[model samples]
Target chain A: MEELSKKELVLKQAKLAINFGVGVIAFASIWVFQFTIFPDFFKPEPTIVEFIPDSTEPESVSYFELDSADIENGIHVPTGLIVDDGCQDVMVTCGACHSLDLVTQNRATRDGWKEIIVWMQETQKLWDLGEKEVVILDYLAKNYAPENTGRRKNIENIEWYNL
Target chain B: MSKKDSRRTFLSKSAIATLAAIVGSKVVFAENFPKELEPVGLQPDEVKVKIPGKSDQLKILNSKPLSAETPPHLLDDEVTPAHLMFVRNNGIPPEEVDVQKWTLTIDGESVVKPMTFGIKELMDNFDHYSYNLTIECGGNGRAEFNPPAKGNQWGLGGVACTKWTGVRLKDVLNKVGIKDDAVYIGYYGADTHLSGDPDKVVISRGVPIKKALEDETLIAWAMNDQAIPVMNGYPLRLVCGGWPASTSGKWLTRISVRDKEHDGPKMEGQSYRVPKFPVPPGTKVPDDQMKIIESMPVKSIITYPKTGAIIPKGGSFEVRGHAWAGDLKVKKMEISIDFGVTWKTCELKDPINRLAWQRWKINVKLPEFGYYEIWARATDEKGVAQPMVLPGWNPKGYLNNASHRIGVRQG
Candidate 1:
């Protein structure tokens, strides 16, 4: 039977510990050197783009309230009347939902508006007009009618831009 | 003990220690970096999950058709092609119809009589006119809101400026004298409501009386120089200048004047409201908890040399942008070359229309060419210019009028 002396055993253990310690030290040294010499290589550079942070807060900009001063200043003067030929009563009743501006701004004939009214009744479930439909149609026909004024000047000059 | 063994052991231990140090240090460094500074690359393939059927059968605004899947950022052009314009239908688009079969009926509580008429009779009966107006989505520029808001994130190009051919609104009002008790006028489009609770009611919206009399407002049948694109209300639509885009209905069908304000899905509950005060971004405002939306704030965007364009340094470069306001004219546009340190007022071209966007062009020497960040800010007639810093945040994204900052290479 081979027997190891205590001193020999101690030496063997010491040698193993030293080898492990040295190997670790060497690996760490390489990492330190890399970080110092090439720090940027580890991290990607951020995009150099500037973006304006949008505010989610809704700002109370302004609304179209009746401005006597604006009208008096001649900025927005009252235009002449718009009456449909056969729908005075209907115009009055429909005006209840919105302003005459809503009605007069449109350039449709009586049939177009009629379809809209039908759609509203059938789809939107608007209250029945009872007898006011005829009067409204007459007024729309009389006042706010379609006019073909050639081509719109502003749109005509919108030159196309290349992408 | 072998000398070689001791040396090797010592080296290994030291290496391990160094590795341990590096790993520990890396964790600390990573935690300190800000999220914004982190490289979050472009998500080219990102998909938006939306509420179902909300976007079905959406029409393109221009002649150029766009796949419904197109991203909003891809629409950065001088004029958003008709197909590229955002489609925001209140209801399903109606199939084309014969004008012969069409009729417009005006009804509801009013002093005048209720009426309905055919297209021929209406056309033969009334006067008509046209005007230029700008229509924008109510949620346009939502992406620009700080703190982030909840809604469709529209880019800057959601708005389109076009000449609307129609008759005067005041003319019709004059025909039907209001009974003074009328409070609101509601409009309905030909579109069908999305799949939801049937009891929820059909889509409708309304505007007030005073605005109806404004001469600039019109009932338009034509957009640009041609018939109104089908996506934009083919038969007839309202054109209210300086109003929120949602107020101008599309696929318009019916108009009813009401004695009192009508309460409905889109009238009192949707579209035309703002946060009473600043809230956190991305918050959904509760219904009956916001202020009514009104005029748009002064805003501008640079169109030329687009952001991130490479330009020759020290050469003469032209910077141009479009500026507009709710009710005022653009008196001045300023350019900052030194990143807000110095500013030079740019030259503005003559305004084509009194109430439309004005083009401003600035020829700058761009002296000492280098990679410079260029920005443009517009000031309105009211002396209100774009704020350098956003005021705050809200649940519903509203006005995002921050000046534009474009990156350009000067060299």
Candidate 2:
């Protein structure tokens, strides 16, 4: 036990000596850096020489991409319009000239919509709809007919939250 | 501790950590906890439809001929930022507009002295002036029409205020001498029709001779000290303050002075016209009776706290907003929390200049924690106050200057 204690004292002294040696070395290194490397901070040249590293790696860069789902869904992209059950031809023809919202948002009777078509042809320079006019009008009037798309429901009609 | 003891403790802790990581990976991924750590900043959210040169927050009402508006909350800035200004286009903007080659022609039947001036000539010859003017779409409240108006169905967001810097349109008109019989002035723009027809003009609207001569009316080249955004007309546009924004033609290339009222394409057939008399909802009025809309009505919008703002139970709400009347001044403004039954007058400030919207604010300490709506109304210099409910319905659903009601909650 006495021999073990003596060995422990030797180990403790060694640890102390090692710590003192490390402190001295650290001080010397800092002093050397101040005179050698640190002088560059006061140089006439810009200290931040090419601070931005060359971007050769793809991992560092990012880009925004239009998701194919966004285009098919017709929400993010402006041309993404409400797709009715069977209006593929309508989508192609109408979307080619102008937005489909002009057709969907306008709540008109068959005649009202027809008048619009005539106006578009007369002044707005829309080409003749041919036989497809009737079919497209049928789809529009059926789906987006004049319903109650006015202002928000009155405060009385909305769901109430208790105080 | 002894060295061996410390090493054993470290090894055991390291083993426990590795075991925990193995289990945690499975649990976190399965339970959606890993989604929290997954980077979201790199990808764009699908909800917002980003428009070029516009805030992504803007609601796009139509894509073709691109019509969009800023929600009242988003339009809370005193002088609306040029980028944030709403877009109301009748045709696609001209592409690759070379500012150096841009020129404006002044001619028509009533112009005795027809003149053409390059943009540089306009800048060098005339004095430049800047004014913060409010420009609200005629169909701003069209969505509120009961029968559902046939046009863009715009909400209250289709309005904004901005500073336009340019020479007075009146000064330009005087330079190009107007005949004694000059009744109105029409403007032509570089924008082509939707059909790609070279012959067709997108929109050629005009104000009366008196309105055209106003000091605020400008042949604007700069908006907020910057070349105007392409959506708001890049090189030049007419700034017809206090009138329907449609009258403020964009992409201006030519001005035609007319002996009679300007009979431009959109000037006729109830495009920007209201009924001669107050009509019932959904009344089919004739084109002759549809009078041209001169000035907009007095209106106020609550810009602060947004509509769905929630305050702490004991907190008092501070309400702020802007008010403007077409061609006149907003004299008094009031806020009603109890549905116009009792109204507390808000401290309304005078406009910075004529045609600029005046800002106002009030602090309300509500009695209870509950759902509440703050209704704001304004009276014009002519003693005209906004109708609390929907105003008289027009065929095209123009000018429904009803009180702006912002619904809020206290909890």
Candidate 3:
């Protein structure tokens, strides 16, 4: 057994006193919190909010909905698809399922349009177009065909305006 | 082109215009006049009927196939509220879903015994568990790509961390008895295709069998202890945390185990896949070379103080946000005031469970602030830190986990 010198014995007593004090403080804090702070009884009921929609508001215009009426009435907006006989077939056959944006967003070639049609028929459950496919193809290829095959040009430099 | 028309400015440069611009505002418009009548100046979904049970702040990207996103500030909550969760739909959610009649059929090349478990049966038989999991769109930051990719232009808001309650997908797969040859698992949803073809599915995508069997991958029926919002796959959904949300099919109807990769809509043909190698922005990679996006990259969003925030004169404020790594733990969270010149470590906390996003906070002390962009970057356990700038871009614009930054003005 190692015997402690007088100085070592005093230092060990101080370390023991600090440890005991810390332990007592920690235990007391835990006891105080468990009794006062963490009570389990008499919990409040949870409130769920019910949603109410305004019944009287008028319909706001959507960009998609805004031009749809003009397109349906055969009044050509200078911006939209070319108004020809084939436009009707394209509208009814293609627009029946998805939005026209799907068509207008693309700039594909004749073969590309045909390829999309084939994909639709094979996967999207489009009925066989037979010969009507030719007319629809013509409209899409002529109007929406590739003017550019890539994405929008990046704006590299900005010209500052003089105020 | 006419000489005068080509030289003309968009808004007239009158004395009043010049004075007004110089007096208070620093904004300026460029030199082309738009000819078309701008459609109703009202914001999207402003005049239209509000989507029931969604935050008014959710930015609607498209209406027909209905896509919307949460602004980052709205996602400051620790667990994303149901109403604020971003909605990215492939097709219309099936109308009139009956939870009582809901059934999940398990079959395909890899199952020993094909089985159909009713929703009730699933709830009663399996041990239920809840986990806080993160799901982010594969194309979360598509808007930043130069020569912009043509898809939903999402910013940083297409993600959420939510507590999902459900049965373990592995437990159910075990009941069905997976064959040793099982290579992949795919799910089909009841969402109607835009073509409204009863026969055609909207999207059917899945993950590798190993990912499918993880503890956090769930056949979830409830979110935040309540029935999920109808727009978010109400009765049943497969919650594959840490993967692209597209892989976690909404309104799940069937589970198919495949001996090979499941060939479903959007699973191939560059839908959720990216280039096998890094491609320059706008480079169109061939379909055969593209690979499906699996576990998402390490990402973080500073969801406090909002962008364009004005800091108080003190030059001190606490910055807090969420950080997540796909199928891994976040090893470190850092903030850069000098745009990657130097970074300050934040107090990062561990996630409550595997696949949950970890929260981090820091007392940001700005050196001197005029206009500073506080950038948040997260590093995963594998030591892969987020790229400070836009990452390698592919045609579809997927998996852009760049460091997120917000502008703050300080004196």
Best-fitting candidate, scored by lDDT: 2
Worst 10 residues of 1 chain B by lDDT: B37-46
Put the candidates in DockQ order, highest first. Answer: 2, 3, 1
lDDT of 1 by residue, B304-341 (tens): 76566555655677888777786578898998988789
Q: Mind listing the fnat for each candidate? A: 0.00, 0.24, 0.05
Docking class of 1: incorrect
TM-score of each: 0.56, 0.76, 0.70
| Rank list by lDDT | 2, 3, 1
Model 2 C-alpha lDDT per residue in residues B218-269, reported as the tens digit of each score? 9999998999888988889998988999999898889999898998898999
Q: Candidates' DockQ values? A: 0.01, 0.09, 0.02
Docking class of 3: incorrect
Q: How much is the lDDT of residue B297 in candidate 1?
A: 75
Model 2: runs farther than 4 Å from truth?
A: A1-86, A149-152, A155-163, B1-50
Q: Per-residue lDDT tens digits of candidate 1, residues A38-150?
A: 98887988443322223662221111122344244322233112322332233223322222333433444577567557755654444466444665665555565555432
DockQ score, prediction 3 = 0.02
Compute the lDDT of residue A154 as modeled in candidate 2: 61
